[model samples]
Target: MDSGFDLVSGGTDNHLSLVDLRKANVTGKDLEKKLDEVNITVNKNTIPGDPQSPFVTSGIRVGTPAATTRGFVEEDMKVIGGLIWETATAFDTKAGEIRAKVAELCAKYPLYE
Candidate 1:
């Protein structure tokens, strides 16, 4: 929300957040690929009234369980949210910087330590 993205169903009461990508002028397919290129994993999803097909959705589902298991705190999530916004808005220009930040976070909490 703070990152200028809309949440489908208003907001989440649990660990998942469904981000509508219409306002960002990108498709869930595009953003998912971009995020993946930068090492961020997310799933494409369809929002209520989505005009796009399920395979090329207008939204992406973000979840916290994996990050939480890796020891990501709220502050780290804020940075990640900012990174997601950057990836969605200026991916071509900020991909390197975004990847670096992601590496820093992953290094901070090793996945299999």
Candidate 2:
């Protein structure tokens, strides 16, 4: 993958991205929990060749449709991606910062007028 992300099926041709995190030594459930803690919604996924249970998957599924629906654009998605990465790698230390950023983004792109 471009940024060295461990992607499933090698790459993506759609809106959704399936990230294999086995080599990272992290579980999808933990990653999802970390993302959720900072308001970055994501779902656990079963990547090809995954050897873990669904409840403790080795991958995560991330998409930007909901954010786009809330008025987010390409740049915002990039920012959110960075925040997600930070939170995934260092949840406790980056929670406040990521949450604040997510709040700012959501406010700028509110669901309703």
Candidate 3:
């Protein structure tokens, strides 16, 4: 059975996708930490062929359109990128601070009217 979710060439139909942690050496936990630092919210996902539980997957999926709609541009992406690097590099030391920052960012660019 083939779901339409899969592309014609057997690829996934998505604009942005996450690489598997086992293949990339970066875990979803680490990715979440880094994204938080820059106020980028993301959800962890299971690898395409993995049998692991979805709640504890090894990949992080990112969507940029939401941020863009909230007025984020390329320059903002640079700032977010830096923060992601820092948070991932120092997860334990930065989680709390990053959470607060994420909250602030959301307030600045609320999702709904």
Best by TM-score: 1
The TM-score, computed over Cα atoms with residue i paired to residue i, of candidate 2 is 0.87
User: What order do candidates take by lDDT, descending?
Assistant: 1, 2, 3
By summed lDDT, the worst window of 10 consecutive residues in model 3 runs over 1-10
Per-residue CA lDDT of model 3 for 4-113, tens digit only, reads 12222334355454545443345676676567555578777777765456766666665677888888766665555445544555556877776676677667767788
Q: Which candidate would rank higher by TM-score, 1 or 2?
A: 1
After TM-score superposition, what is the CA distance of residue 57 in candidate 3 from its true location, in Å? 2.8
How high is the lDDT of residue 19 in model 1?
94
Q: Tally clashes: model 2.
A: 0
lDDT of 1 by residue, 56-103 (tens): 999999999989999999899888888988999999999999999999
RMSD of 2: 1.8
TM-score of model number 1: 0.95
Q: lDDT score, residue 56, model 2?
A: 92
Give the candidate number with the greatest lDDT. 1
CA lDDT of every candidate: 0.93, 0.82, 0.59
**What's the distance in Å from true for residue 64, model 2?**
2.0
